[model samples]
Structures are given as structure tokens and as C-alpha cells.
Target chain A: MNYLHLLDYAGVAVFAATGALAASRLRLDIVGFIFFAAITGVGGGTLRDLLLGKLPVFWIKQPLFIGICVIIAVLVFFTAHLVESRYRLLLWLDAIGMAAYCVMGAMIGLEYGISPYAAIVTGISTATFGGIFRDVISGEKSVLLSDEIYISAALLGATSFVFLFSMGVPQIVAVFVGVLLAFGLRAAALLFGWTTPRYKPRQGRKIK
Target chain B: MNYLHLLDYAGVAVFAATGALAASRLRLDIVGFIFFAAITGVGGGTLRDLLLGKLPVFWIKQPLFIGICVIIAVLVFFTAHLVESRYRLLLWLDAIGMAAYCVMGAMIGLEYGISPYAAIVTGISTATFGGIFRDVISGEKSVLLSDEIYISAALLGATSFVFLFSMGVPQIVAVFVGVLLAFGLRAAALLFGWTTPRYKPRQGRKIK
Candidate 1:
């Protein structure tokens, strides 16, 4: 439990940093950086809790989480120019955060007695929805719309956790495996420039 | 209660049509049209429900609501070419949908014993968030970023409803007034090209 809590906090800080980096890229003000950071830090968990009918929301219940995000945002705001290749940094940090979040989300779903299929979906959503929200708000194309294997990696991770759990694997072991799978896939995709195929329209077929 | 239900259904249909119109403008396929319509129709209410910790979201429970949205999307898909000035039609329909949704969201918030201030925020969010989601997904800039009075109108309408409710006004009458205020404000804005002032940075002022 303690380890999970640490992972959760670390995931949030990393996500917040990614959002702050995005805000810096757009040259937004400090307020914009904080707002984006806070949203990206908790957006996925908030959505998962909402879908699960959890009350008060996690961040609302624990102001410490938001405080952490704000602090990270402020730090990123002041130090953005000190970093080179901000985009690469954002991608790696986001990948690690998504990996941790996917496991946490899947566990929460199972704890709530949601069906396994639904739980996997919840996990994937938790891992990816925050980035989607951030991208949309910042006028960047959503990860979902890209050919990158981001969501697929989350889905694979989530499914592995659920499958391993159902097969009598220890909860911690299952989570470890899931996180490794997600992080490994994402890292490989980033390093190797792997991508999913884009949908191509058929010739002479009117889309409308 | 029945009247409220009717208004909800009508609002969903109207919102769905607007989404379908957006898809048509983007030259998306049938699946895209349906996807956009469904999201726009239920996005605001779903967010409200999730935030309020309401289970089994409205559309999931009813299914009829989603069915109606799908039907509307199909209709818009087929009839898009027959309509002149689809953009104008979409704007008008979206305004009407926002008005109805604002009142419905306020009523739901009051039923849940939320504070009046929060309830008003809920109303405005419920009226406008769907459009924001739609715009984001369609790769269009959200109306919130525009100098338009859209969100302000929702805020005004929601505040009116909550205030009137607190003053012991009848629910139906308060709702009527709220909807009228929102609709009228939006209509006037559309007609007269009313706009709020945009924020301009001072010369030589660093944003950081």
C-alpha cells in the first residue's frame, strides 16, 4: 500500500511536469502552466472516479495532491529554459506516468467489482484520457488521433494486470508486470519510432 | 417531471444534430458522425453526473437517449447537402440545446443538495462542456477561446435559475425563465455579433 501511494504521487508529479512543459512550449503565463499541470495531473483519475461513481474526487479529498502539482508546475515554469529537448522529456515522463496510472486504475476498478472488460477499459481510459484532455485544451492533436501506439500499450498493460490477477498472481506482482509491459512498449515505440497503421480511405468512396 | 424529461430529450437531439453538422463539415464518415453526435449529446450531462457521483450515467441507463442521438446523426448525415448554411443552422440548434441543458443541470444539482454556487457552475458546465468536447475532438478551437458570449450566457442563465430557486420560485417557472434568458442572450449574440473583449498583452511585457 505504501509503495502504491508513492507510485501514485510520483505519477502525478511526472504528469504535471509534462503538462507544464506543454504550457511552456505554448509560451503561456504561469497561471496557464499551473492550470494545465493540475488538469493533466488529475484529469485521468478524476474521470475514472467519476465513471465509477466515486464521490468527492481524489484531489478534492486530498489537497496535498493538488499542492504537489502546483509546486511542480511552478518549478517547471521557472526552469523551462534550462532544459533542452523538452518534447522528448515530456514524452518519457508521460509514458512512465501512464504506466503507473494504468495499474492503479485497473486495481481500483477491480476493487469496485466492475466487470473485467469494463475494468480494462477503465484502466486504459485512466492512462490516456488526461493527455487527451490536455492536448485538446492546448490545441494539439490528441494522442488517440495519432498513429503512435500509446493507447494500445495502455490497453495491453491493463489487460495483463487483469489477466494475471484472475490467474492467482500476487497483486503486487501483477501490477509490476503490467507497469513494465506498458512502460516497455511505450519506450520502445518512442526509441524505435514505431507506429500503428493509419486508416486510409478507399478510392472513389465518398466519406460523407 | 415529464416536461423536464421532454426538454432533456429535445436538447439531446438538438446537440446531436450540431455534432453531426460538425462531422459533415469535416467530411467524416458515418461512424464519425455517430461518434461525434453521441459525444456531444451526452458529454455535458455525463460530466455532470460523474462529478456528482451519480452512477449508471443517464445515457447508459436510458439507452433511448443514445438511440435518439444516433438517429439524429443519421438524419443529419443524409440531409446535410439539402440544407443551406449548415453552420448557421448548427449554431441556432446548439443555442437551443444549451438553454435546455443548463436548466436541466441546475435542477439535477439542486436535487443532489449541492450548494447554489456549485449548482450554477454545474449548470454552466453542463450547457457548455459538450460543445467544448465536440470542438476539441473536431480539431476546431473551442468557443470558450473565442470572444463569444456563449459561456457567459450559460452562466447568466444558471445563476438566474439558482437564485430564483432559492427565492422559492416554482421549479417550472424558474426553469422557463432560465432557459429564456440563456436562449435570448445567445440569440442576440448571434444576431448582433456581440463579443467580449480579448485580452491583449502589453508591448515588451514578458509573459513569464
Candidate 2:
């Protein structure tokens, strides 16, 4: 298999692990883990395809994508407790998945003739929306709701790809540049607790 | 507009109102309120159409469907507190929207040549998934997670339509039968606290 295909599958596996880990924390049933894993792994791309009018979505024809998620989820369900620091694992794994997905999503958008700006937006949605759906559906505070650098990292990656490609960079080079930059920023955020600057608070604002 | 069109619009408006009300409870910003409204209004049909491979989705082509949701959400943002019993209003409005969406989803599914059983599944997904996403994203317990009769109501409506249509009932008559039964059941559940039967206690089960 090509490197891109390998990256794609690895991304799916890592994200699925995160999802299954979340399900384990919630003490959900096996079915819940698989459901969460499947959605988290595929949700972002599904949204991208649907919005872009790509018929049948990416996973419908080759359900091996979904099968990978299901298997990972089941594995995590059984072995999650063995992980020393699930939260840290979740962050590191999510960083890997997010970068790969961001580039992949942008690639698809560009292929579909979407404009650069909208393609970046598509990339961001692809990388982050799945985790948002996963956390939200699980009654966890959504990642987007946090005043963190997570989504900003995705934005950076997508923008970098668009800019590089527009500047005549080879598609492969642009993709790697984007993915590495995004993953690096996210990793830094996790390691150093970097966060977005919060808005100056107005009095009487009840931030729930 | 035809009767079906009226139902469709009204259903969207009501669902949007529910979404806005949920956002109000969460004290979300106006943008958040409107975003919630649009998703809650169109989320189900979006899922249905995407799965059925109906390209561009129902809203991408019309745009008016999204416009209606935005208008309702904004109106509700300023007026939600005026309602004395927002929860009661939410339940009633949800009942109306759910019934209409269920029938509409089924109609589209059957039109696409999906089997009746899968069509019913489609209807349930279309009617309930939007609300599921709304509540989950808003950090509220999802309706589907509750041991309630909500999905059952949608199931009944879709099934009734499929049965009536297959039995040579007029299409319009079948539609009405489905919508009415769904609404009736949901309304009854709200009024009477009619819940799904729970399994007999397996003690020490942490059904969180």
C-alpha cells in the first residue's frame, strides 16, 4: 500500500482507540464502544463528503474502514485499563489522526474544485468534527468548547497546504508540510499546555 | 403550498424552536443558538439524504429550509423566556416535528426503493438524529439515551405508513396515518409519562 493509504489507516486506528477509550471511561457496553469508535473514525470524512455532494461517502463501498474502527474499539474496550494515562494517550493519538485527516480532507476538497478558503474550512471540519461529535454525544465537554489550541492547529495545517499548493509546491510535499506542522503544533500544545488567548471578560458574563 | 409542504415547513420551524430553547437553557451566544437551530431542524433529513445518496442534500439546493430554521432560532433566542413552561412547549413542539419528519423520511426512503424495514430505520434516524446531535452537543443527555418511548413513536409512524402504502392505501392517506399515529403516541407519552418497559433488575448493574 502507498504511504498515504498507510497514514489514512493509522489515523483511523488511533482515532478509534481514542473513541473506545472514551466509551470505556463512561462504562458503556461493548456496542457503545463500537458505535462511538465507528462514528469518531468516520464522522469527519462523512460530513466532508456529504457537504461536497460526494455520493455514498468514503466508507460505504469499502467498509473495511469501518471494520478497522470496530476492531480497534473492541480491542480498546478490553485493554483500556492497561493504559497508564489514557488522557495523554488520547491527546497524542488524536494529534496524529487530526493532522492526517486535515490533509486528507483538504486533498478531497481540492480534488472537488472547492476554493482554497473553503477547502481549508473543509479540512478543519474533517479533523475536528468527529471528536466534537464523539465527546458531545458521550456527554463529555466538547473539544470545540474548550479555549484551547486544538482547532487552531488544524486551521494552520489546512491553510499551510492550501498556500503551499497554490505556490506551486508538489501536492505530496504540501501535504506532508501541512500534516507535520499541524501535528507539531498540537503536540506542543499537549506538552506545554498551550491555549488560545481568551477574550477579555465583560462583567456579568456567565460563562457556563 | 401543498399540505405536505406546509407540514415540512412547520416541522422545521418547530424543531428549530426546540433547538433554540435548548441553547437558551445553556446560555449560548446568538451564533451558537442559530447554529443549534439549523442543525436540529435539518440534521435528520441530512442524514437520510446522505445515506440515500441524494446529492447536495435537501437544504443545499433549497437554502430556504436553512433560512426558516435561522429565523425561528433567532426569534426564540429573544422570546424563549417569555414562555412560562418552556419544557412543556418543547415536548409538544418536538412531538409535532418528530411526527412530520418521521413520515417525510419514510416517504423519501420508499421513493428511493429501500426496503420497508430499512425505510423505517431511515425514518427514525431522520426524525431523531438531529435532536440527538443537538442535545449531545449542548452537553445535555441525549433523548435516545433515555429509556423513553420517543424512538418507538417514530418507529410506529414509519411502520404504519409502510404497511398502509403496501396494503394499497392511497399514498396521502398512508402519510396521514403515519404522521397522526406518531404524533399521538409522542403526545400521549408526554402527558402520561408512558415509558418503555425496563428490564427486571439485575442488581449491581450500574446503568449509568
Candidate 3:
């Protein structure tokens, strides 16, 4: 299998782990865990494919992806109590998944002949949307509302890939650099408490 | 335009209105209103098209639908205070939109050669997913978790449509009957405090 395909599987697995962790936090039933895992694992790619008009979606065509999500969910469900710092583990796994998906999504967008700007948007969407879907369905506060520069990391990765590819870099090299940039940035943010500035209400504004 | 086309426009408008109402309740800014409206308006149809592998998504091809969502959002933002009961108005509008979209979605599924069961699922998803997306993004409790029998209503509509069509009923008649069934069920549920039973934990089960 190609590197991209390998990254895709790893991304799906880690994303599914994060989803299972979220479900455990919510104390949802096993069905909920599976549902969350499947959705989080495939939601972003599904949206991207739909937007690009790609037929059958990636997961629908290959049921193995969903089977993997289910297996991960079952594993998480059975062993969640044994894990230390589940939330921390989830964040790290999600960061890695985001980096991989960002590069993959941008590459797919380029293959589909989308403009660079739209492709970058697609990449960011692919990286963050599954988490958004997971958080929303589980009724948790979305990471989008957090001060962490999550989307920005995805943006950096996608832009790096597109720019490098435009400059005639080989696909494998471009993908490696892109993934490294995103993962490095996200890991740094997680480790060092990096955050973006929040919009503050001006005096006498009566912010709602 | 045909009745299906007319219902599609109405569904989009009413769903957008419900989204705007949700944003207003959250005291979100104008941008939030527009964002919610656009997502809720197109969210269901987008999912349906994606599942059926339909290309270019309906709203992407016709920007007018998104434009209408924005216009409605702007109007609602300016005029929300005049509304006597926003939630009640929202529920009613959502009922109508759900009814229309349920039949439309099932018809589209049949047109795409999907099996009856899967088409019914598509119909339910089309009717309810946009609202779920809206409520989730707005951080409101979803109607899906409510006891209002919402999905059941959509299932009734879709099944009615598919069964009638399979029986050689005309498209217009099937659609009309289907819409009426869904709307009537939802309206009755709203008026009479109808509710489905929730799962109760068994003694000694220690349900998580």
C-alpha cells in the first residue's frame, strides 16, 4: 500500500479512538460508542467526498473502515477504566489524526481539480469536522470554540502541501513535510498551552 | 414548477427560519444567524445527495437557496423581538419543513434506484438531520433525543410515499398523502404532549 493509504488507515484508527474516548466521557451505552466511533472516523471524509461529488463515499465503498471503527469502539468500551488520563490521550490522538487527514484531504482536493483556496478549506474541514460532529452529537463544547489553534494547524499543513506541490515537489515529500508541520504545531500547542486570542468586548458594548 | 419543486423551496425557507430562531434564542450575532440558517437549510439535502452519490449538491449548483437563507436570517435578526413565541413558531415551521422534505427525499431515493428500506432511512435523515445539525451547533438539546416521535413521523411519511408509489399511485398523490401524514403526526405530538417511552435502567444493572 502507498504511504497515503497507510496514513489514511492510521488517521481513521486514531480518530475512532478519540470518538470512543468521547463516548466514554459521556457514559454512553455501547451502541453510542460504536455510533460515535463510526461517525468520527468517517464523517470528515464523507463530507469532503460529498462536496467533491465523489460517488459512494470512501467508507461506504469499503465496509472495512467501519468495521475497524466498531472494533476500536469495542476495545475502548471494554478497557476504558484501565486507561490513565483518557482525555489527554484523546487530544494527542486527535492531533495526529488531524495532521494526517489534512494532508490527505488537500491531496484529494488537488486530484479533483479544485482551486487551491477551496482545497485548503476542504483540508481544514476534513481535519476538524469529524471532531465537530462527535462533539455536537455528544453535546460537548466544540473544539472550534476553544482558544487552541486547532484549525490553524490544519490550515498550515494543507497550505504547506499545496504550496510544495505547486512548486513541483514530489507528492511523498510534500505530504511528509505537511504532516510534520501540522503534527509538530499541534503537539507544541498541547505541550505549551498555546492559544489564540479571543475577541474581547469593547467598553460600553454590552456584549451578548 | 412542480409540487416537489415547490415543497423543496418551502422546506428550505422554513428550515432556515427555524435555524434563525435557534440562533436568536442563543443571542448569537448576525453572522451566527446566517451561518445557522445556511447550514440548517441545506444540511439535510446535502446529506441525502451525498448518500445517493448525487453530484454538485443541490444548493451548490443553485446559489439562490443559500441567498434565501441569508436573507431570511437577516430579516429574523432584525425582527426577532416582535415574535410573541419564537419556540412555538419554530416548532410549527419545522414540522412543515420536515413533512415536505420527508416525501421529497424518499422520492429522490426511489428515483436513484435505492431499495425501499434504505430510501425510507434517507427520507428520515433528510427530514431530521438539518435540525439536528442546527441544534447541535447551537448547543441545544436535539429533537432527536426528545420524546416527540419526530423520526417516527418522518418514517411514516417516507413509508407512505414509497408504498403508495409502489402501488402505482401518481407522484403528486403519493407526495401529498405522505406530507399530510408526517405533518399531522408532528402537529398532534406538539399539541397533545405526545411522547415515546424512554429506556429505564434495570435494577442491579448499574447502567452507565
The number of the candidate with the highest DockQ is 3
Model 2: lDDT of residue B62: 65
TM-score of chain B of each: 0.94, 0.94, 0.94
Model 2, range A45-105, lDDT digits (tens) per residue?
8888887798688899779999999899989988988999987788788889899989888
lDDT of candidate 1 vs native?
0.83
Per-residue lDDT of candidate 3, residues A1-208 (tens digit): 7778899998899899999888777655564566578779887888888778877677646667777888998888877776667777889999999999998998899999999888899998899999998888878888666777788899999999999988999999999999999999988889997887878867775754
Q: Write the per-residue lDDT of candidate 3 for residues B1-208, one digit (tens) a residue.
A: 7777789999999999999999999999999999999899889998888888886789989998999899999999999899899998988999998999999888898898776766776787688889989988787887655556676688789989999998999989999999999999988989997754422223222333
Candidate 1 lDDT over residue span B57-134, tens digit each: 676456677778779988987777766677778889999999999888988998999999889989988999889888
What RMSD value applies to candidate 1? Answer: 7.1
lDDT of 2 by residue, B1-208 (tens): 7888888888888888888877676655554566678778987888898889886567655667877987997788777766767766777888898999999998899999999998999988889988887887878777666665798999999999989998899989999999999999988888888898877877585764
What fraction of the reference interface contacts is present in each model, in order?
Answer: 0.14, 0.20, 0.21
Query: Candidate 1 lDDT, tens digit per residue, A42-138?
Result: 9999888887777678999999999988999999999989888998899999999899988888888888877676677678768877887788789
Each candidate structure's TM-score, on Cα atoms with residue i matched to residue i, is: 0.61, 0.63, 0.62
Off by over 4 Å in 3: A196-208, B1-46, B55-131, B137-139, B145-208
What lDDT score belongs to each candidate, Candidate 1 first? 0.83, 0.82, 0.85
DockQ of 2: 0.13
| iRMSD value for model 1 | 6.6
